[model samples]
Target: MQLLEERILKDGIVKPGNVLKVDSFLNHQMDIEFINELGKEFKRRFADAPITKILTIEASGIGIACLVAQYFHVPVVFAKKAQSLNLDGEMFTSKVESFTHKKVYDVILSKKFLGPEDHVLLIDDFLANGCALMGLIDIVNKSRATLEGAGIVIEKGFQEGGKKIRDMGVRLESLAIVDSMTDDSLTFRPNN
Candidate 1:
């Protein structure tokens, strides 16, 4: 996690409207070797959990989830922002509002991939207002699956998402928590 914090300080860009652009290495253009280190850290963090599947939202979270799943040796299931022709059968759905995009989407997941028998670990690139993760949690609840925990690469600690999720009794782990950010500076909450 210290490594991730260092990377953010080195490469992350702070934009107006509370956006921290990590696209250069974390999301848009990825660093697999770096992500693999993150994956190893996640595995170490949740090593005792009986994780059967890693669930994440589509787009940004997918790649990180896939990398993390390799360590867990589990399949990655992502909630699609929209329904598509390739999807079929009964589905669990929830509405999510994107903090960055300023839009709402009805996220959906196939019921066949999740159920009461499996344990799920939610993965994502960032946690802002918690809407996306809330949507995924709704889908998991609908499927009656056990929610093991959530692994987030970066969490905007200045925002309410992390607290809200933790208050709901979910185990949330964030590799780098930016306590505050400005155009010229960024601060991180120390992990202890």
Candidate 2:
């Protein structure tokens, strides 16, 4: 995770409204090698869990989740932000508020991909207010799938998201946790 922290310091941009834009390597134009490294780290972190499926929300989380799914040797199921005509079966839906987009979306997941037998590992690009993650967890619960854990690429430690999820007794692993970020400086929580 030190590699991720270093990368964030070098390439991540601090925007107003407590936003950290990692579009350069993490999300927009992805660094495949770096993302693969993250996948490996996530696998190592949740080595003991029986992960049958990797669940994520669409847009940013899909790429990271796919790479992580490689390590688990499982298929990735992303909750779509918009309902499409291709999706005909029953769906598990949840309302999620995006911290970055500042809008709420009805995230949908097909029931065929997830069920009571699945042990799901949720993956995401970032965790700030925990709305998106909680929404995914809600979907998992509705499907009766066991939530093995959650893997996050970057977590804003100063935010309540991490604490809230941990309070629910969910195992959450964040590659780089930013404890504080200023206009010119950023502090990371020590990995312990």
- Taking the tens digit of each residue's C-alpha lDDT, what string does model 2 give over 1-192? 999999999999999989999999988999998999999999999999999999998898999999889999999999999889999889999998888888988999999999999999999999999999999999999999999999999999999999999999999999999999999999999998
Q: Candidate 2 — what's its lDDT?
A: 0.95
Instruction: State the weakest 10-residue window (summed lDDT) of model 1.
Output: 82-91
Kindly list the per-residue Cα lDDT of model 1 for residues 1-192, writing each as its tens digit. 789989999999998899999999989999999999999999999999999999999899999999989999999999999988898899999999988888989999998999999999999999999999999999999999999999999999999999999999999999999999999999999896
TM-score to true structure, per model:
0.99, 0.98
Q: In candidate 1, which residue ranges exceed 4 Å CA deviation?
A: none
TM-score of 1: 0.99
